[model samples]
Target: MTAPQCPVAHEVFDQQYMRDPYGTYASLHEKGPVHRIMTPEGFPAWLVTGFEETRDALADRRLVRSIEYAGEDYRTLPLPAEFSTKTVATEDGAEHMRLRKFMNKSFAIKRVRALRKRVVELTDGYIDAMGESGETDLMTAIALPLPITITGDIMGVPDEDRANFQYWTDSMLGINTEVVREAGATMLGFLKRLIDDKRTNPGDDIFSDWIAWTDDDGKHLDDHELIGLGFMVLLGGYDTTVGMIGGGMLALLNDRPKLERLRANPEQIPDAVEELLRLYGTAHTGVRRFATEDMTIGGVDIKKGDVVLCSMGAADRDPARFENPDEVDLDRPNLTHIAFGQGPHYCPGSELGRMEIAIAIETLLRRLPNLELAAPADSVQWREAYLIRAPKAIPIRY
Candidate 1:
């Protein structure tokens, strides 16, 4: 005998859904851990709602990420051009190991820790610029610029070209097909030129490292791979960090008591960052995985070729793994939240991202102790997209 189907008719992509996904996810968990539902793009897929199931799915070799291994039926699902970019995100097994190995040194703990002083200096500059404004769009003045600047430096983006890089990156996140195409093309062209420039004048940056990296097998990234990896790294390092900074700040500001608690003892900033990430992760969805064979997750039958969208946000808030999952608890002992995701493809820049966010919060509290949201919490508009769950702007006053 087989388990009966339990298809859910929930809308996974609505703006309202993005606003209160934890609530919706809780309801979905009532139906079951795995729900067959429509994606924001209006395609059907399986969403894993359970904590353990999502963790397992992320590391499951049976759930292949490359569309090359996708079942014929699942192949019809529309994929962003980024999918075909052949970056680390798209590969698995040996090829993934090769790419991960080559990129490891650049993100190693020592390298990321060495960036702390730079991050502090950058944060102070941004705060100084915000000095007399009295009120400012935190997103524009601080959250967005800090990480973008750092990633720009790391990728060797010319200071003069950063404005264009910002435009292309923002456009790449657009839902409009024409805009995405134009932005993608412009970014690719920019990256090609950047890579070419690095060939003759290699600098002490990740781009130069990728150009010069080698392993025992003599493996290295070619120009094409470099372009993909470069764009992916930039997007990963900037967008997600911005989201965490902005979102985490809101989480702190909204709860004055908690804010004051952390303010009183800054030693807990790291743990507070972990709790903030767990409560409201930057991404609601995880990397898409296609089932290579029939499987049952949390007692739901998933067929071969079916696309599984693991909801990391949903998993993080699962009651089974978290107590008072929706509330931000700085003392939450278990920081096993998969905000940066889990398994082999775990975000390469997570440590750096955490440092950026923690420093951003600490700097704000110290510099502007009276900082408060300039608008009502409910009025802050969130991005109406599935890819990133972040506010459009976080207006603030000190």
Candidate 2:
């Protein structure tokens, strides 16, 4: 079947597009729900945009999500063997649901609800450790540490070992080739050691819980699955939340009045979290999906094996999904955007994710009311990336 005409100025994978896709997404969304684009590897794919259609398309299964289509190489950047495993994002159907079911109990809203106080403690302590610095990088001082510690807490790692694990986790996700390998090796080894330790002396952490967790027929994550799942949670947890904190902080700083409002009433931080997520969700462009069957969507025809790309970054900013979408309104009503994505593949750590961001914004505002951007907005450097995007570093003086 012939696909609809493409609307982007350049292929979605093009470096220029990566730098800024807001304009392209606006143009494409106006055309319809979807349009064809070239993948980072230059392969043809459909970029879903219309808010309703994007949600519908993600819910529909004509496009399968599985490792079968994920070939050896990543679509954009070069991927090492460490990332080759078919994660929850890359898996499909029953296997996907099965894995997700196993995780649901642990990642449920109720479980995360119980973690609220703890999330605050983590956020507060990280801030306390900052002592008395006239200026500090929020990402390093708070954003990066909160989620890293949270991930470590979930995995049952010792407090002392967290800094080491956090370092390698970043390394693996980093673009540096050598750093990636070193991180992969280090993380794998540490997880193995941690797993061995858990076997003998399991504690009340996610890793220990998972070790004892089982299904109706006694299904459980095997050792290999354990390693993969361990790496997956850390990778997803640390970077995504860290990016959210960094990006969200920048958003809040740009709207200092809004930041002040949230600070005045800490109880309002939850609404502030929703608004921040809607305004500054982090994700460069998410992964690609291949059609397993013919499907017509958003006035476009998608054939079997046709690739589908969903950009959470673009979808969150789609004006149709949000009222006054670009503007940050703490009181925005019915605020729902696909920052953590939609459908069954929605980020499992979302509740925890929200809490982390909420606490980060609240603590920083309360403790460092004088927080001022140390770097010029135009002068601030942005890291070049395709899978994830965040400030290279944010300088702030408080």
Candidate 3:
């Protein structure tokens, strides 16, 4: 006989819940580490909010990303069929290892580290475009465009094709299933064409590097797999960075003392970046996993085939895990946070993303020493999407 789930007396996607989720999550954490909740997608799921529970569950091999391992009811998500077939997030075991290996090679630390100069140049270009501005939406002027342009350039996307790329990326990141499917298919088609171009005109970029990578048997990722990989790189790094940089800047702007501290010590940008991510990282929906077997987490029973959403935001703010969970402590120890995720699906672009973020912070503070929010923090709008949490526009004045 199985134990019944412990449903919380709260809603996950309540309008107030979406606007500011930390306090609500903290309250939920007090009730229990794991709660039975409905996903924003309307699926019944287990939500793990405790720090230890989230870390352990993330590392658990029995809880997988592969939809094939999902229970019959869980498999009925309204996603496109192709979503379950490929992509790093939907794979498990040796197959996931294979895709991860390909990605690891393409985004090797050395390779990403080498891009620092180019990233700086790109960052500077965007700052230059700001032109000592009176006011501008940083989300548009800097935060959003920088990563998209960089990802586009790395993927060998031509300048003329970038607007379409951005459109598809925006559409795909939304909560609407039909919009996501249509945008996904469109992006995949565009990626296929881009990959075809790389086949003939290889260059010094990630796409070209992937084109050159081949496994032992003289085999390489087929066109479909390549398309999946391309989508993974582009989508994975885009909006997440946008939210981090934009929300992160807003966080600092709202807290002038810390902003001054960081400005006084530019070298602290790295630590500040990590702290910001821990506090204000994107991905409110968190990562989803399907249980391959019955499991007990945080003293709660989670049955096999149960869908789990690990709240990275809640985990990072867990009082038991950090000394000052709510405060932005730049001097905090380099404690591992699941902001970039954990285990097999850890973000491949983490280092690159971190570099971009650090550069964004340092560049902004240096170039626009008087930079401040153009509007009240409460008045700024946030995107209401399930997967990504970010402000629609971070209005800033310098």
lDDT of 1 by residue, 56-87 (tens): 98888888788775654453322245435477
lDDT, model 3, position 55: 85
For all candidates in order, the CA lDDT equals 0.81, 0.73, 0.81
Clash pairs detected, candidate 1: none
Scored by lDDT, model 3 comes in at 0.81
Candidate 2 stretches with Cα past 4 Å from truth are: 1-4, 7-11, 30-32, 69-86, 158-186
**Candidate 1 global lDDT:** 0.81
TM-score to true structure, per model: 0.94, 0.87, 0.94
Q: Where does candidate 2 have its weakest 10-residue lDDT segment? A: 71-80
Clashing pairs in 2: none
Cα RMSD to the true fold for all candidates: 2.1, 3.1, 2.2
